[model samples]
Target: MKTMILTTALLALTAGSVSAQQVVRLATEGAYPPFNFINDAGQVDGFEIALFNELCTRAEVSCEWVTTDWDGMIPNLQSGNFDAIVAGMSITDERREVIDFTQNYYPPAFSAYAAMDPDADIEGGVVAAQTNTIQAAHVAETGATLLEYATPDEAVGAVRNGEADAVFSDSDYLKPVVDESGGAFVWLGEPVQLGDGIGMGLRKSDTELKATFDTAIQSMKDDGSLNALLTEWFGGDDAPQF
Candidate 1:
């Protein structure tokens, strides 16, 4: 009886250890504001970080956050540098060809143009956009001269430095810049809606993990918790309904 009990205890401990090892490493750009950004303390803190924590808890999975450069986010994910990406990545057919995404957590959002000159011509003037983003691709397809930067801040800086006529990016990310510009930067043109929405990215082989996050996302949507977070971060009625 004593021997049997000892063997059962050992098996239980081993099982618990295996379960504990099943942690998912979540990656984020940590540069996009209101979504994921490095705070004053130099720690990753934002809506996506908070949302990802909640989703991991609901999915019953352990998660560790990893910050990566925006341009290399997808490549690093494919190289197994991380388990998943929770950055402000939009769900698009072009991206879908390279990686699978969970159901969108945020609804489709619009991109806007910002420049020092309120009357800057968005169609024909030089524009700056972060490399490897939807805005960059859109700028390339337009009549504007596209200048690509490695980071969003760099793209914005181009406009401030007079290197580019305007900077085009996600409205949510650029709105705060315009607000804080103190009459220096202003909106240049009508905002354009792009992509489907923002979702977590995972490898094609990570179907089970994707399903776990998808279920958690759906739960948040059904309970209105996701909307609450969206409002808390984004503010106003612009948050899309689930």
Candidate 2:
């Protein structure tokens, strides 16, 4: 009886260890504001980080966050450096060929950033969202300039430095940039809609993790935790839903 009991305890301990060891490593473009921006002290702090922490708690899994460049995000995710991505990536069929995504988490809109000069023809028209974003189709359809930059900050910088006529991005993203730019740039108008909604990116093979995150996200939304976090970070609950 004693031996059997010891064996069962050992098995339980081993199982617990294995379960505790399970960690979902995530990659993000730590520069996108109100979503995954880095703070003044250079720590990760934003809506996505808060949401990720909440999901980690609900899923009862350990999570590790890492910063990656915007352009390199997909390739790094596909290469298996991380288990998933939650850096404001949009859900699109073209990206589906290479990876899977969770349910939409945030809405998208295209906002143009140009010099504060009102006379500038800042409208670059509808262009693609880099090469990998869902906005590729819109860019192709509209034949917009499709300005490309390595990072969100750099793209926004182009306008600040007078390098580009305007930088097009989601409205929430543009607001923070405008704030940081200190009036060097201004929003052209209400951000135009462009398949706006954010989603988590995961490898197709990690379908189980995707499902887990999806359920946890839904629960967070239902419980108002998601909205609360949005309000905490974005100053209101009217943030675009995913």
Candidate 3:
């Protein structure tokens, strides 16, 4: 009886280990371009997707990608709907209170104002920003008439339709829009640098998962793979260094 019990326990332990090595579910907001977006094939594709895949490979883990709206991301994470968030989520103290974050993969960048009119008043005019984002907070703090949208694209649309005087968001996101706007939209003022940087969000209880990703991130940084990926996505040679 004792020998049989020992064999059963060993088998159960092996099963548990196998389960822990299964695929990790990674979530992202598929609407954010360059960072993460739905490609023409109706699949999530972008810098974040590529980077996450590489990270998983380096860590010898498998991953499955899922798209979730920005508003529900943190809530879903907390409720165990997914394993980790690879969305373009910035690292801030407020967010850190709710969810733990891996080391920053992307450095904190500037937020710029884009408007149809060059002389639009950034401080007093109606400024559109994606709801629940750092840009929205910045607009409110600056005493601007803040118009919150569900998506970044909608914020830009508010400016185009004259509903808002300006749209404030990441320069990486807004720059491409302005360039393709045929001179219709122009940057209004200097960009504002906010937050620490972008990092993967994980449940506070998932310390092992976080450590796995953190090690992968550090490995990429040490080997220059992370910087190479940044330049590939953001363009130019200004990729941040560790």
Question: If scored against the real structure, what TM-score would every candidate get?
Answer: 0.90, 0.80, 0.91
Model 3 clash pairs? none
For model 2, residues 77-152, the per-residue Cα lDDT tens digits are 8887777887888776677788888877665545443445555554444222444554434544553566666666
Runs in model 2 with CA error above 4 Å? Answer: 1-20, 108-115, 122-131, 134-140, 179-184
Query: Number of clashes in model 3?
Result: 0
Model 3 lDDT, residue 45, Cα = 84
Looking at model 2, residue 2 earns an lDDT score of 9
* Model 3, CA-based lDDT: 0.84
Give Cα distance to truth, residue 168, candidate 3, Å.
Answer: 0.3
Clashes of each: 0, 6, 0
- lDDT by residue (22-137, candidate 3, tens digit) is 66778888888999998887778899988987887777666778777888888888887778888899999999999999999998888899999999999898999999999998
Per-residue CA lDDT of candidate 1, range 51-129, in tens? 9878877777677778777777888889888888888999999999999999999999899999999889889999999
In angstroms, the error of model 3 at 62 is 1.1
Which regions of candidate 3 fall more than 4 Å away from where they truly are? 1-20, 238-242
Q: State candidate 2's TM-score.
A: 0.80
